[model samples]
Target: MATITSASLPRPATRGEAKLFAEFRAFWRAFVAKAFNPYRPELHYMRGPGPAWRAKHVGLSPAVQSMLAEIRTGKARRSSPSA
Candidate 1:
């Protein structure tokens, strides 16, 4: 018996990517439900982030902090040109 191996065996999806995909699917389902039932509580939930989400990642690298400040004050439109 001979064993064969291909040069390009597809890489398995990482756990993080799979989890993200699951979250995205849930969001999609919620969105569709909201579309058909505008007054549903889940509709409001799916609308997006609350204060907690914003507050969780408040700390950032100095470079990122500066860039965020620039954006907040309208000095930049994301992604520094030099970078």
Candidate 2:
């Protein structure tokens, strides 16, 4: 492994070289933006805080919640000898 220093890095001294580096930096930023949402064309430039599906879902939809309610009843059925 080698360490890179700012003094050893190449700096754009000419207008043409500086313009090339600026375009490359812009392209790299856009590439990273698309990588997160490659499929959403409408969301190419706008990203939300979270996934839309999670807005009203938790993998425990109403039906699952109803099915899990029996656990409470089972606990109620096991009293401490009515004491």
TM-score between candidate 1 and the true structure: 0.34
- In the range 1-83, model 1's lDDT, one tens digit per residue, is 99998798889889999999999999999998878875756555776677798789566789999988877867554545755
Residue 39 deviation, candidate 2, in Å?
Answer: 7.9
Model 2 misses residue 41 by how many Å?
A: 7.3
Clashing pairs in 1: none
Clashing pairs in 2: none
In angstroms, what RMSD does candidate 2 have relative to the true structure? 16.4
> What local distance difference test score does each model get?
0.81, 0.76
Shift of residue 76 alpha carbon in model 1, Å: 87
- Span of 10 residues, lowest total lDDT, candidate 2: 46-55
**Per-candidate TM-score against the hidden true structure:** 0.34, 0.32
